[model samples]
Target: MGKLIISVNTKEMILKSYEMGADEVVISLNQCSFNGLKKISLEELDSNIPVSIFFNCCIFPEQIDEYHSLFEKIQSLKIQSIYFQDPIIILWAREFNCLEKCIYRPETLVTNQMDANWWYSRGLKSVSISPLITLEETLHMIRNVPNSECVIHGHLMMSYSKRYLVSAFTNHNDLPSLRNNYDLTIQEEKRDGHMPIYEDENGTLIYTDFVLESFNELPILMKKGISRVFVNGEFLKDEELLDALSIYKQIMEEKDVQNQIVSFFEKYKETSYSKGYYEEKTIQ
Candidate 1:
């Protein structure tokens, strides 16, 4: 089975995840990620469990020097992997002679086997398969790529834009600015459910209307030899995340998975959960 990787914000959460049997924990550098996860400083990253740094934000040319310096500082830490969005980071990794520590994680770009294999061949330890792809597409990439990662649970980011859409809309309507407000959501004119939307310094992000859960497909993912299964903690309370972690741990340990999955669904019955695009096929 693949290792369980959870996103965390604080050192306390890090230690707690370790105690809860998480194989590795990922932390976003403050000011480096587009997603709305609580970010932390480099000085606070000391932990016994393996740590992967997430720097999956788009970069501006002016910010390159700052990010480059930050990247250099992080090289001294015992980081297991660096999940990145910008290809410039790959250049920095090569310049630092640590290309093997990189994992390409452009949210919806690595959807095909050829693109995934190309990155793997370029010496990345792994590439995160796009969560938007169908299950068959994901399985194909896993079979071809040397190492693969999948987001098994979390709010899937459906779109990201450099423009401050929420801010623009609110300002246009003479309403108070809603930038950086995590509680804000938007809905399509014809859509029934409200999708979470947030704007940060980087840009605006729109997430899936429902949290994507993969209890029914975890067995298949494990059997397919996925390198890692990620559980995102953004927008989730600590108690809820801990409950989810416990349930996933139980299921991965094979202690009556059917019961555990059932329990997992029951526990989160109030929250909207879906299989995402796992079973959905696109028109060719």
Candidate 2:
């Protein structure tokens, strides 16, 4: 079976994840302060297990200079693995000769085996499967495609837009800052549940109708040929992330996990989460 990969933006989160048995650590520069990461030299990283850096923003044709500078910066650091969501940046990485270490992080709609094959053919070592597809569909891709990965728990990415849709209409500097000081989740007039929306350097990202939790289905997925599972808690806090990591590790390693999962759902029942899409067809 594949291994577990988790996104940890802070130094504390990274240490905690390693303590909790994460196979790989994904340091997201998009979410954390770069100054903190800059302090972590290659020697420090070299001493650690497999680690990947994430720069979730995209590059446009007009920003060719920016693209060059970004790649140079990453290369100068001597980091080996990275994940980028932008098509232009992916191409730049390919041309810059680090394509083998670059993995493609696609939007949550790439479910077809042909699509996975296309990316693999382009020399991407790995591709993240969309969480919107059923477990069976995900398994099919895992069997047909090499080095395929998918999210197993936490919030799901529902939609993404290149434009800063919310900030465009507001003159207020502090947008996406609700009364709760967190991302806002709203339900449309007739929508089933609340969906989280936030704007970052990459633009607006919308989550699914509810957080996606597949703790119980994870073992089956591993058995069915899913070699890798990503624990994506980019929207969560440090404490929450630690708890989440421990829970996933426990479920994966412990023998009596059914009751643990049930208890977890009970504790967070007020917070909406589900494995609905894992059993059903893709959402329209």
Candidate 3:
């Protein structure tokens, strides 16, 4: 069976996930990963479950030396894998001789088996199946790629920019800067729901209006030989996130697949959960 990997940012969340029977927990490296998720030091990652470090920022020339130092420090730690998006990480992973410990997660890029195999052939541990692809495309990659991973649940990131768009807007308006505000959100001119938007030192991130739920698809993914499944805990209340973790864990353990999915759907019927692009084709 594929292992369950849940991204977490706190020591408390780590312990809670461990107690809830999660196979592994993901934590982003301080100042190194993207998204508005809280970052942590390697020291705070002490826990029973295996931890994967998210080193996902696009590297700049000036930050090369700092990245090198951080990579050196990570070598001594007990990390299951490193989820990276930047090609700069590829160089550092090779230099550190830890190519086998890396997982390429370029968000929306790994859409075909050809590209997925290319990265796996280059020695990455695995590559995340892009969330924007259809289920058939996802299953194809899982069957062909040796150790593919996918995100089963969470708010999907719609866009990420290196420019501080939120701060730029605020500054231009001469209003109080809400650059670091996590509670800030935005709505499109024609869109119905308010999407969460935040700006930090890394950049600004915009997420989808609805969270993506894959309860109905998880069983099929497991049967298709997927290596790992991720449940992102971002933008969720603690109890809600924990409940999700518990339900997915239950679905993995229980024999009645249909019943489990139905129950899971009924539980979160109120919340805006979608299959996203999993069922629909982007073209035609």
Candidate 4:
């Protein structure tokens, strides 16, 4: 059987993930506020279930001095795995002397078998296989890298760039802009309800819509030998979480292969779906 990994930014969501039948939960330290970090530090993370911290590679470069304290705190919490995007985080992981405890996974390179093999050779225990990968690609990776671990489920990060379009629009010369209100809030008022907003340092807003409602594809992923599934609880509501977990549990409980395939497709058809940045070939 495979394991379900849910990533959350708050203790409330962490507790909610357990109720939803998650095998493990990852706390995203970059998204949480200082108070939130303190709360997690005080909480009982060393319980029956596994609790890991996801350290964003882009945020914690090796050049920064503050990362030392953050690494110390992670070590103190006895966190077993640190999920990261960039290989640079691996340097920090090595500096902390936690090579065994790090999982080097780039969000975009999940489908690249060569990249996965490279990371594995460099001491990465697990790598996030691309969500956009076709079923055939996944099978190829599974066949090639029999020893590597892969993330089967999680919100596919569609686009990550330093460009701030909202800021540029708000600062247009045609309109008289307020001096202090540089902040822009971008919202997608669509019925699918999977929009994510990011606020930059200058308070500029960036809208991101990464739809991950792929409960139907679980069987295909499992067939490819994916043992670990990850869900982004940061964007999911309690009801949605329940629905996802229920679907996962259903798949886990079923022994009949024919019934499993039918159940997965039925659920997939019922769930709200979106393609996100991968929907178009051109960059936004």
Span of ten consecutive residues with least summed lDDT in model 4: 30-39
lDDT of each: 0.83, 0.67, 0.83, 0.56
Task: Report clash pairs, candidate 2.
Answer: 2-227
TM-score of 3: 0.93
Residue 32, model 4, lDDT: 22
- Sort by TM-score, top down from the best: 1, 3, 2, 4
Q: Per-residue lDDT of 106-153 in model 1, one digit per residue for the tens?
A: 988999988888988888988899998898888887888877898988
Provide the TM-score for each candidate, comma-separated.
0.93, 0.81, 0.93, 0.71
lDDT of 3 by residue, 95-197 (tens): 8899998999988899999999998888898899899989998998899998899999888888999999988998999988887676877888998877889
lDDT accuracy of residue 217 in candidate 3: 89
Q: Estimate the lDDT of model 1.
A: 0.83
Among all windows of ten consecutive residues in candidate 1, which has the lowest summed lDDT?
Answer: 41-50
lDDT of 4 by residue, 116-217 (tens): 777777776676666665556666786676444544443444455544444456577556543223122334575544444443422322223444544556
